[model samples]
Target: MTEPDGFRRAAMQWLEKRPDSRVDYSWVSSFEYEGSRIPLMDRQRGIRKPAGFEAALAIRTTFTAAGKLPPYVDAIGDDGLQRYKYRGDDPQHPENIALRNAMKMGLPIIWFVGVAPGSYEPIFPVWVVGDDPEALQFALAVDEGQRFLRPDFGLDEDTRRWAEGRTKQRLHQRVFRSQVLLAYNGRCAICKIRHAELLDAAHIVADGRPNGHPVVPNGLSLCKIHHAAFDHQLLGIRPDLTIHIRQDVLEEVDGWMLKGGIQGVHDTRLAILPRNRLEHPDEHRLEERYVEFLAAPVA
Candidate 1:
């Protein structure tokens, strides 16, 4: 794909400023560039500059700034894929022009274009080859909540504000997400069934009201139904993390779903306990809310 001019310029400028880190060239020969395989042995001997060096780094930095960079790329492993070795002209080479173009546009080039599907192991960090000044600049700006011009990059002020706001929300989401993930051990606390796509970061205490702290102890890992129920005060968790179904809610048919099956079965079983006990919900807070939940009539 063709890269936007602004992105390309920003990417180039970033690359020009990157520090030259020593690269491992073990996988160099496995790389294919321009429909030809570069010899691994030749790459080890340092015959030439590997292809697409700038592009790979650009993609890495962009994704890292976006907070979507995969965990594997942050650290290298024993696998050949992470070794930073490749041939100069192999078509499958990491340092290819196509890969570089994808990175400049903020696409998932490493996984989408470079790595094979389902290849789950550590991979090299995207910025290992080149410096990513553009990504670093953007991350710093966002972190500081400062406004800056990246006219070439095309991220306008309104867009930047929106992204910055989302990033803040994501920070909150992550704390809750981690608490929930640990409490449920990556499963739904109410369901006991593990499905990543169906899981949610449910606040044990509601968000942004007089009572909400929006912290780890105030969150739970719930499936969609349970999360909604908790949010609407249709359900509550005891200070012990046990499920608490509002008495009046038991009368409705939909309440039956909450009172029976997976939800019902989970009642009183301390919602999947967190491995770290310190992260557990505060008893006083849960007790206070539990009292409120009990006093209110079920809708």
Candidate 2:
């Protein structure tokens, strides 16, 4: 699906700030219910929202985040529809009922599955695109992305096509970027530039190299230019968390951008480390990848 429009996006940003909750689906039955939806204030404050299905959008979702694994979200039809089941055979399950009401009112639903580790919440927006509920009023949700309530839900295609089209490497790259961005707080580790679109999570070791996994410690948030430089060995990071510019790049004649941006900085402490030492870059991987950087052809 394409991303939510600007108005919706802006509203979502405002709604998400200081989110009231982490998203538990159980709150639906347990929390106060008015008009068959949680009160706006309570929903925003993260109160109880097991049956989130709010009449609006927030960072988590209109329904917000679902705890652990949602009991619903059971099946996807061959033609690209999401099938949500009620617990056991309870026809009047609160979740099922609320979903039916929303569908009847034609209100769209969005929710978070779970936040990936070291990342912010992910959103999965699905509407009642179909009406084949086994029991009356059983709700159906479909982004049909064959996907997640993740940061980049926009890339989701229908489950069938998505599964058919995406590769393991591409999936890893998208998920890895999100994880690295969260750990590094969405800035370039070297330049400390804060533009999110320009940021990249670079692998300390090359992708698919021996022992190179795309986990947080193995990734560094780098801007596009630095990512290229590091990949090409124009830049190197040491085991001790210092930056090194290859001598040729430093000494060769160059433009202002090359001088100030790339070649000028040498032996600087890696500018952006994760807040938690545990999430910081791995020295062992740094040691290994540095060897590859050193051996890179000096162009």
lDDT of each: 0.44, 0.56
Worst window of 10 by summed lDDT in candidate 2: 58-67
Question: TM-score of every model?
Answer: 0.46, 0.53
Model 2 earns a TM-score of: 0.53
Error of 2 at 54 (Å): 17
> Which candidate should be chosen as best, given lDDT against the real structure?
2
lDDT of 1 at 226: 74
- Candidate 1 stretches greater than 4 Å from native: 1-164, 209-215, 254-259, 262-267, 295-297
lDDT of 2 at 285: 94
Best by TM-score: 2
